[model samples]
Target: MLASHEHYRAAVAQLNSYAHAYYVLDDPIASDEEYDILYHELKAYEHAHPDHIAPDSPTQRVGGSVLESFEKHTHLQRMWSLDDVFDIAELEEWVARIHKSYPNAHFTCSPKFDGASLNLCYENGVLVSAATRGDGIIGEEVLHNAKTIASIPLTIPHKSTIEIRGEVVIPKEDFARLNAARTKQNLPLFANPRNAAAGSLRQLDSSITAERRLLFVPWGLGFVREALSQSFYESMRAIERFGFYAPKILEAQSTQEIHAYYEQIQQERENFSMMLDGMVVMVDDFALQERLGWTIKSPRFACAYKFPAVEKITKILSITNQVGRTGVITPVAELEPVEIEGATISRASLYNYTDIEKKDIRIGDCVIIIRSGDVIPKIIKPIESRRDGSQTPIAPPTHCPECGCALVQEEVILRCCNLSCKARIVESIIYFASKRALNIDGLGEKIITQLYEEGKIASIIDLYALSVEDLLELEGFKDKKAANLITAIAATKHIALWRFINALGITHIGEWASKELDRRFGLACFAKSYEEIIGIVGFGQEMAESFVEFSAVNHELISRLLALIEPLPTGSAVGSNMDSAMDSSGGDFASSAKRPLENLTFVITGTLSVPRDDMRERLENLGARVSGSVSKKTDYVLCGSDAGSKEQKARELGVKIITELDLEKLIGF
Candidate 1:
């Protein structure tokens, strides 16, 4: 037993040293195979003597507990974002502003990792908790998941309380491997490493997070009980000594040096193990940073210089028409295969015929395709100089590609008026089973297409009628798979009213609008007239008219669908028959004395501490209407940090501006 105890201690010490060498110093004394063999021996010993295992042991990273939901935690110090500078001139202006305050200021520039921001709090040299940057002040505690990251040390060398701010990212190689595994399991692929890292780090299951292999790179310090140095660069180096992956820093004394560093980082961005969106330049002196302080949303001491968007030239092989669930026909350009930012691209959206004509995009023409941030890849413009006489002009199709019906043009959009268009039907069914709608697991696009092609399912209603026996006949379905699919379909019979409304594929009605409609009218939304819908504060004339037309044409179909599914109450409306109550009250919705803020219209703008969508929902639940823009009729504007032109326009129109604190007071929260 004494020998076992000594061996355990030695293993833990060796593993911690190896981790520091590999993660912090980027140098290793032992090969990966030797490390793995030693790690397994330590894990086996720990498993046999669980009570004897140390808290800081490397084997203790994967916690056994699963969280139901993340709890809100108030940050000890505010985590301010950095102001962005898009061009060199803006960066120069930022430098000049900083120099005006500190004439001898020097800066430290480092890559701004493109991933989820995390705050790690350590007490007495041991990590106690980790939280996400939820609202700068309040964050979600994700300690269980955060402990799984190999780069985050469970115990540091410094025996003091400290808070480290950094980014949690999935390395590019791990991200690709994860996506490949997901593809094999028929799960949706993560769009990028940032998204994958964010999703993985926020998992409710700590085991899943541990499996994801996320890495943490500390870039800034939130607070330290014991000061290591007065300079930020020296403090970062001190942090590195405590076993953290501190970002590589470059010192710049002038704007030219800063620009040169930025260019060098941008050129070498693809070579990094993780994704980087930009570079952050901060004044190196802590005293100067304190003097500079902060603006409303970001720090005045530091600024981010974003790299130019990734663009690649590819030839458009052909243009094809894709019909949406609403029967709107969109033009898609099939491009020659090209790789950009670690992703392979073979297609880009042409939007509509109007966009094609405006850009003069043609087949066989070399076009500039760009992927900016999270936006979809799009064609910037056709390289007219490279276009030869062999290039052909793309013409809009006069007939629907799926149903051979006449196509109708509505302003800039083209649509197939045929309700029975196969493409439209397939798309609607796909959407009905989507995560936002009925949430029927195992009903993916391939299966839906197969069912449609085999004439087994015709509409959304047909999904409820599927049985295990019917699914067994499909190509990929074994007995267990068939039963599971049937069970999944059955589980979706009771769905949220907003999801049901959105699943119907009503023109101009999205998930948010559906929720609003369900809130104001409830089950009686089916009986609302065009004028009554238009009377709603947020509903536009076009949306109202579209709803009325759809209801008039498909009343029986809608009634049949509603009978097959039960809508869960939203709790947003006081009664289930709000339309009947309005009718009885002579269509005067203002007569309801129970409704607070009933007649008020609000416009929300800028970055709120809380999510904007959450704030909007809270307001709507209190019987207030939220609009997308500021207008003369707007009663108030809920302004947050960096409130832009909307706040200015509200002031000009005599609309009251309210802060987040004011909103809380008004809502009596």
Candidate 2:
């Protein structure tokens, strides 16, 4: 007879599986938390049965896998990342700069999304597409799943063209249920709701994609023909008009008031369903945004003040290990799943043995796990209170988990067999075919995992050897997908030399390295001459040394890789202005332009009726950027009544001090 505890175990298993279908898959097969009660019951059983263990346990796997690749797509606008402010001082400094610019600069503070960043596209006010923040310029489209989000309205009131940008996130309770199901199914679980939603949104199939209950909150508009409001709140109401969930805005009159708003958000962390990573403070006026302008990346006007992450102390139940794409062995702590920042965190990465030693963490010892800002939970410290003699030190692995190859300990890292490890074969294949690299359209990580699990394809070299029969048998793949994968791989055979260089995933070389190489050498010569690279601009001793190390490390593979990508084209022949930037001196533009304010340095001090940043920008547009602190080089100080240090400094330096009115006259208003 099955024990009463076994009944609870079975119930828990059913609940978690259904939860996965509903939460992870976004296909709700059962009522919400129908599985939760079962999960709770199973936990009760586990508390009773410390001896009985389930191997295919949802309780086991760490959620979220780093995909080998993402398919590339053009962003409607672009998914620009927000510039960060570390502290309140930076925020205040930003406010002060604004005060100098626009006299009537009243600002609003909004809860900065603590979820996945996205760029959403709509045509005729109908939701059409969504993409991840891959780079600022390009992202992968996952519109099918994004459409299922009720909060992300399918149609808007506007008849004219419109597009918006926002984030997609999984709510906390839903995240827990999905994880419980994965635990029961013994499938790998998600690390957090944010990452989980991101992974789900990227799925290729519309049906598979629709399963994650993602919420899209339109933070700001993208490409809209007409202005919604004169200010930021009006824009929200406008987006709301189009049937999208607009974020709550906290309008503040002063910088002090803005700080008060952020403090309130911090105090109300758990009050909201979607997590609040930080506070995004911005001036409301559209004219002001135009006046302030932008940096190359972000708008000059806004800032995200990230909240101090919710942290809690928990016991390190035990230690475990996981093999990564490179076959590097990493230590992970199995913590007693504790609540912090609206989610239950059971695991934290120990990076390597170096990390293990640095923290001096031990099994059965108490440790503090911190979830700060946008999280990948980190270990803060050991509690020392729970240090019992029952704790044991975990030794680093001697062999690769998958291939059984001997492992080696580098200075701070642990490595398995260099070229031949199975972990690497899968990872390299994935990287070799990623969006920025070769971009094999149908080649998802799930497929690669299956191929690796089934022993159908072994190495990236083996990917060339894959036949029609090799891909057809994988679950969800069909005749068309197999053919498409094959065609994509064939097309990838003739790709950019920079893409080839980048696909190799060298230790420190990134997109920048490959791009730099493209500027110096075209594809054909690049493959042959990359080894000769040393002492170029930005190419330093360490980069060259790593290249030399890599040559020795992957000699045979590199040779094969060269053979595949050699005849392919290089990227654009446009030599980077960086290649020989000294060849032309455009510094003469500032010196050449007979500016009205050429030699004059203006330091704006004290509050004006307008934000100083706006005032500064206008002065700059007329060709005079404001100086922050007063110095001997300063030509004038724009003083307000409370002007303290800067006014005093200007006086000591014998500098001309101007009022806001005088300052405007100098800029030739």
Candidate 3:
């Protein structure tokens, strides 16, 4: 056996060599598999011989590796942030300033990733470590976990140690898969995939990193070895030549082109393999990039053009049925709306059966479909009723179409007949790939549905049976795309086991709950038997029983399914408050003069129309809270638009019905 000192030195050499290949040369020597062996060995040695572990080891680059509890890491570089400008006018002002500074300045544009930024270090291109831009400098180390991502090459070709930066993301479709998985497991929802990915990467254990199937795209340039002489676009080209997956950069010939490009990309957002928040504009010239220099946070040379939310109108042709991972039957409205957003709009979500009942949406209804631009299009409401069969109620499916099992209804959701129902197999695969669940890349709704329909796949376990050739044969699947999808599936084996647990679409479980289980017991230990897990802090009888039941019935199935996933390391401990970790911005907003509501709830009605959401978030930040519907606890109802029932409800509850102006006065805004 090698001595601890030898092991330490060996690990350093291995990591450093990896960095060299990945950064300086853009070529790689060691495969990730080879590097992983060395790293794991080094980690094992360090655990056994902590004293021998060198401080400057590549492993030291990250912050939260193996930490049972995290001590706050103060950033070496203050995490100064960028000031945001949402619209074109602000973007124009920014450009004008640059033009004013150096007349004859033009711009170049790159696609903005809608994912989280990360600082990466490579000791010779074998990715040695990764950290979030937590506070700016010091961040949780997730080397073991990051290695699982296929796009993040383990070693570079030329071989020289380097630290690089990139964004960690889940593609838009993958975000949908994750959310679907979460829905099946009854997990709390994530607003978008960007939020989901950010949360996933921040987990302490690198093992959890493996399961997230995060894809890193080199966007902003961080550390460069040789003197660079190229345009911003050329520089990015240089970066890509170095073997990184550069962000998709498109040219905008005119303002219309720029808008069109943005719109085009936004329309295809769902079709992409990675998520993007906005598009970045830059000068293609290297000298121009240098001339632009850096702002406190963002570089002055580039500007991000944010896409507006897509909105459109469609007639509700009919309500459609969709089986979820947990077998919940969802009602979707097939539309005939002229596509206003980038892509065609043929469908919109009606949410659950309760929503259907509430909206009283019927077939052939003239409903307005809203896409919010980039995200999924959803049904707003029907324009009263045109020809009404009195707003036909969609009957819930009573049995699994793919398997003979009686459907069950609870909480207003129509669920499949059996937990392992054949119909649920496609749904499960979709859930497994959703943005909130396992976050598998390239696995989309139509694709998963097709796989099941073709009788080539069933159950989440069936995903493992797929070969690249299988994918290649499918429509629109290309060589690179097929490879990427296969790689993504292979990489998922190593994801945080809790993500797997959460992806199973269990009852009474969510990301938060899965995390709770991970915190209380490691995935391996927790999965052994439900009885042992029940003893955990919050594992009540109901939750405990459910956990046990799922395990008992699905143990073999989950085991086989897990075998298909690549084994990723678990996250280390961090300074996280389990309940509050979602987004730990402290305290709600309230004006000093008004005295913050401190969790006080209020309602809104009518249309004074500052856009209700705008007012709501503003109030929330001010410490005053707002709820959608009126309730007894509502202190005030800010009235706007067509105020009818809500206004009456406010009066009946003896609650104050205030105008938008009144709300403005109260907040002193």
Number of the predicted model whose lDDT against the real structure is largest: 1
Worst 10 residues of 2 by lDDT: 574-583
Model 2: lDDT equals 0.68
RMSD of 1: 7.1
Question: Which parts of model 2 have CA positions greater than 4 angstroms off?
Answer: 1-73, 315-318, 354-366, 382-412, 431-447, 460-669
Better of 2 and 3 by lDDT: 2
lDDT rank order = 1, 2, 3
* Model 1 lDDT tens row, 1-669: 224889989988898888777765668888999788889988888778889888789887866688757899878888988888988999989999988878899999999898999999989888998999998888999999988888898888777888988999888898999999999999999988888989988888899998886889988888778877889899889888877887889999999999999999888987988888899999999888899888767889998898877899999999889987778999999999988887888889999999899988899999999977533588999999997798999999998898887776767888774445667788888877886566677888879999888777987778878888888888868999889888887766556576688777777776557766776787788789998889877788778877776666557767877777767545633322322232332332222334566657889998898778667755654667788889999988999986877998898999999998997787565
The 10-residue segment of model 1 with minimum total lDDT is 576-585
Which run of 10 residues does model 3 get worst, by summed lDDT? Answer: 575-584
Of the candidates shown, which would achieve the greatest TM-score relative to the real structure?
A: 1
- Alpha-carbon lDDT of model 1: 0.81
> How much does each candidate deviate from the true structure in C-alpha RMSD?
7.1, 16.7, 18.8
Error of 1 at 385 (Å): 2.8
Q: What does the lDDT read for residue 23 in candidate 2?
A: 42
Better of 1 and 2 by lDDT: 1
